[model samples]
Target: MKVGFVSLGCCKNLVDSEQIMGVLRENGHEIVGDPRQADAIVINTCGFIQPAKEESINTIFEMSQYASKLIVTGCLAQRYEETLRSEIPEIDAVIPIRDYGELAEKLQEVLKDAGNGSFSKSERALSGNPWSAYVKISDGCSNRCTYCAIPLIRGNQTSKLLSEVREEIEALAEHGVQEVTLIAQDTTKYGLDNYGRLMLADLIREVDRIEGIRWIRILYMYPDEITEEVLQAMKESSKVLPYFDIPMQHASNRLLKLMNRRGTKEDVLALVSRIREMFPEATLRTTAIVGFPTETEEEFQELLDFVKEVRWDRFGAFTYSREEDTPAWSMSPEVDEQTAQRRLDQLMQVQEQISLESNQKKIGQVVEVLVEEREALTGRYRGRSRADAPDEADGQVIFTSPREIEPGTFVNVRIDEARPYDVAGVLAE
Candidate 1:
């Protein structure tokens, strides 16, 4: 059978979809790109926020028109299995997210109505960029942040074995992966569940020893858990870029405490200061929620001030989405959509200026950028520096090379111009 797969949300979820695709291929099933040509459609969804849920629902509906069999999996399926079955008449099956060890067999069981087929076993296929891929170190969330539905959807934290992680990355390196971004519910919490201690730093040191990997970036690190030893490990590894993706949702002590975040205001400030103290040119990226329940202008201002002080190289801000079953859902003084959007705009406006200034500072400095693709029309190459991830959501460096260059080639580019979010440059000899 020709199966079509559509995955949505963060890289962690994407990794799951990749593994599912691998299973489909191993089972002698054809994985088609176009939905119209497939016998069945599989949707690996995200229901992390309100918008994500809407997208997932809409996607299922859209795919349902032509799909005789539609299988819904991932967070949304786990969260709303009964709701989907009752409301969506077209869905054939719903598989909750769980250990996918023998998922090929499971897929056959799900496809019992469609008739069984040959099943083989293999690991996740490399569906993402050839040069870069997301290596999920763990699954689920233990930090029950009040506003987040991750714990409810994905359950508590579970770390993969250190050897398994190493083997995965080693296989990825062998499969032409040059850059690997380690992802988890909380990357800093890796090995904490089963090992009874933090082994993230140790894991990094081990992955850094792998031969073929050029860049290893870790994401979703909790601010307080990032010890000096971790930073030191990052500093020592040539392959490990100094990019800290700390998701400090809010900077106000009151809001943070109310949200059940681990760190205090002082701890956050100290954490940033310490990171900069250790790695002066380290790229700092963070995420924040603008308006939570009962969030006053004073608290917003505190967060704004903190952002200015931290001068994050890349910043992402989202308006608070009041999710169901989360602790904050029933909290009084719910922030209205208008207020939330305004706060979000104000925060992003400040970040725009900060980003421009940050880029301007890089003018004339040669930076190594991994060429991702080239414009056929203009012969311009688009790529990302160490500061940018594979998605290039933060920004990209566009350069015109004297000669044609292939994607995945690392070239030094001298920064010639700066925009609010991107940089224009020329290849440096």
Candidate 2:
């Protein structure tokens, strides 16, 4: 049977989709990229926020039109399995995140000839860039932020064993993956649940020992959990990229408390200062939530000020989404949608200026970029430097290569122009 897969949401969900594909392939099922060509289509849904939920639901409907047997799995399925099954008669199977271990059997039940192979937890059918992959170090979130639905959807944090994580990366490295971005709901909290202590640094050291892997990046380092040891491990490791993706969420001390975040405004500032002090060339990326419940004009201004002060190399902001069951859902003085969107726009404008200024500083600098693609119309190569992650929020280096450069090859490019979110340059002679 042919199986089509549609992975939605974050890179964490992408890992799950990859695992599902791996399971299907092991069971002798052919994986098809197109829904029209498949006997059944598996849709990995995301329910992190209202907009993401709507997008997931809409995707399910769109895939249903192809008349293929539809299977829904992931956060949305985990959170609203009953609602989806009751409402959508088209769905054949709805597997939540908890049942991912039994994915083979679930598919067998749905498609009689789907085979009886057991789920391979470690196997992944890499979907995106062949040279880059996202390795989920852990799952779920223990922090239980007031505005976050991750805990309700995916439960608490569960880190993979250090050996297991190493094995996965070794396999990826053997398969020609040069860069692996370690990701989780909170990567800093890795190993606390099972190992009794934070083991991200140890994990980094272990991965650094692996051959064939060139760049190792870690994302979602919670501000409070970023220890000196972790930074030192990154500094000492040859493979680990000096990129920090610390999600601040908000800058106001009061809002941080309300959101159940562990750190205060001062703590975050100090962390940024400490990181810059240690590695002046390190790439600092962060995210902020613009409008939360009871967020005042002063609070938003504080966040804006923080962005200006820190000048993140890459930054992203989101408007608050009031989801039910979360603590912030019923909080009084809710920020109206209009006000929230306005604040989000205002925050982004400030970030745009900061990003432009930051990028401008890189002008004339020769940076090593991992070439990814070529623009169809312009015929110029596009790629990212160590400072940029493989995401929409990060900037890209667009350059004219004298010779055609293959994707995944690293090359030095001299940046000549800077934009708000990207840079243009020429391949270095």
Candidate 3:
């Protein structure tokens, strides 16, 4: 049957959708871009935050008009399955990630029961606008942060075997996928539960060996668990990008404890220093949560000062959102919505200045940028350098070349102009 898959939220969810797509293709199913053309529609959703949750629901409702069979899967459905079924009448069925194995069979059953139309599921080409693809190394979270509901939805931590993950990377590389971002709830915690210790370094080294894969980036690393071996692997691997995404939710030790985040302010700073010392050109990316429940003005300022002190190359900060079943959901002294928003704004304003300064330093230098695609608005092409990731992080290169550039090809671009979040350049001749 013709199946349309809508992948939502983070890269982890996209990996789930891609795996399901793989299964569908193996079963000779056709994947369609438009829901109207497809026999069924599958929505892989996010339940991480209020905005994401609402977006997922709206997407399902919109697709329901033409889709005869609507399958809602991924985090949102996994966490709130019954609520979704009761509220959304257009949804034919809700399948969580655990039950994704039934996808092809369910599609057949749904299409067969609707006797009005004939259905045939034939494998089609992989269609996406993505310049880079993500590979999930693990599922679920053992960290259980007070503001996160991931563990409740995804269950216990489960790391994919080293060999299996390498195989997946090879498959992606074989399909002409050049940049593969490694994703998980907490990447540093990968393989600890199953392998008796961490093995992220090993897994990444193996992936780096795969031919045709040029850029390897890792994301969602916890502050406390990044080992020396991992740092060494990143430094030595030619394919591994010199980028680190360490999530330190709060800077104050007291606030960190409340959020169930490991490491003190000193610990985090030390790690950052160590990373910078090892890879001088490394671009550090991090996320922080402001205005958590019981957070004081003094504590918030501590975080702001930390940001200034660290001067992270790229970073994002958000106001804490109360999530159900999480430890901090019922905590007293909840910061007012307005107050939370204000803190978030103030923090970002500071980070913006730091980011601009960092970008300014790149001017007049030639950096390797993976040419993603030609921009529709400017008629010039857009892509990212080693310092930038695909979306949340900044993209560096806006270059004009005499020759047409493919999406996965990497070329050196000279930085001519710099902005807070992006850079403009011309391809180096």
Candidate 4:
């Protein structure tokens, strides 16, 4: 069978899609780059919030026209199976996320007469963008924030075996993947439920020893779980990039409790200060939720003030989603959509100025950049520095080059100009 896959949402979703592709190819099925030429189309989706859900739905609808059989999978299907089936009659099958292991067998049965899904997994190479990859050390969320529905959808946190993560990293390195981002609902919470200790530092130390992997990044770290030891490991390990993606929802103690988030505003600020003191050049990224239930104007000001003081290198703001079955859904003083959006806008505007200033500091400085691609019309190469992640985070380093630089190759770039979200540079070699 000739099959195509469209992965949507987070890096975690992409990992799932890669596994499915790996299995399908092992069964001897042909994987096509073009969706229109495939026998079936599989869409891995994300249903975290209202915006993501809408985008996933639209993507499924668009792919339906190109493939004969449409399979809906991932968080959205797991969360709203019946709703999706009823709303989108074009889909032939709906596979929940947890049951991904059965995909190869299901494809065989579905396309038996067509001889499309009969390949073995070992024959197919582990696939996806080779420059960067996402390694999910664990699945699900243990933190039951009042506003978040991840725990409800993904269940309690379950850490993968230490050996399994090491093996996966070895496999990714063998496939020419240079940078791997360690992801989980809460990365700092890894190994707590199963191993009875926070083992991210140990696990990362092992992955750092693997050859062909240059940069290691950790995401979704809860503030309370970020210990001094974790900071020390990041500083000491040559492979570990000094990138922290801590999601501090708000900067007000009252609002923090109302949102069911652990730690006070002071605790968050102190952690930020401590991280900066330890790794001055470290790039800190955070996600903030605005207009949560009962968030007052003064509390919003407090958050704005924190942003101004800390000057996070990267930041994103999202309006509180009144998700069903979540504690914050029924809370009083429910902020209207307009107010939430306004607060989000105000927060981003302030951060934009801070980002501009931060990027400007890189001007005329020499930094290591990983060349990802080149644009023909622009006559420049596009790449990312250590401070920048693949997407979501900031990306820069477009400069004129006499020679082409291959993806995944590291080169020194001298920053000549900087913008709010990108920087211009020339190859230092």
Candidate that would win on lDDT: 2
Per-residue lDDT of 398 in model 2: 93
Q: Write the per-residue lDDT of candidate 3 for residues 251-366, one digit (tens) a residue.
A: 89998998888889999899999999998998899999988999999999999999999999889777887888888889988899999999999999999899888888889999
Those runs of model 1 whose alpha carbons end farther than 4 Å from true positions after fitting are 99-102, 110-121
Candidate numbers sorted by TM-score from highest down? 2, 1, 4, 3
Compare the candidates by TM-score and give the number of the best one: 2
RMSD of each: 2.0, 1.1, 3.4, 2.4
> Model 2 Cα displacement at 159 (Å)?
0.5
lDDT of each residue in 96-176, candidate 2, tens digit only: 988877778888888776555555463788999999999999988898899999999999998899998999999999999
Backbone collision tally, model 3: 4
Q: Find the number of clashing residue pairs for candidate 4.
A: 9
Query: What is model 2's C-alpha RMSD?
Result: 1.1
The CA lDDT of each predicted structure is: 0.88, 0.90, 0.82, 0.83
Candidate 2 structure, TM-score to reference: 0.98
Give the range of the ten consecutive residues with the poorest summed lDDT in model 4: 115-124
Lowest lDDT 10-mer window, candidate 3? Answer: 115-124
- Runs of candidate 4 exceeding 4 Å displacement: 113-128
Clashes of each: 0, 0, 4, 9
Deviation (Å) of 157 in candidate 4: 0.9
Q: Model 1: per-residue lDDT, tens digit, 207-259? A: 99999999999999999899988988998998999999999999999999999
Better of 1 and 2 by TM-score: 2
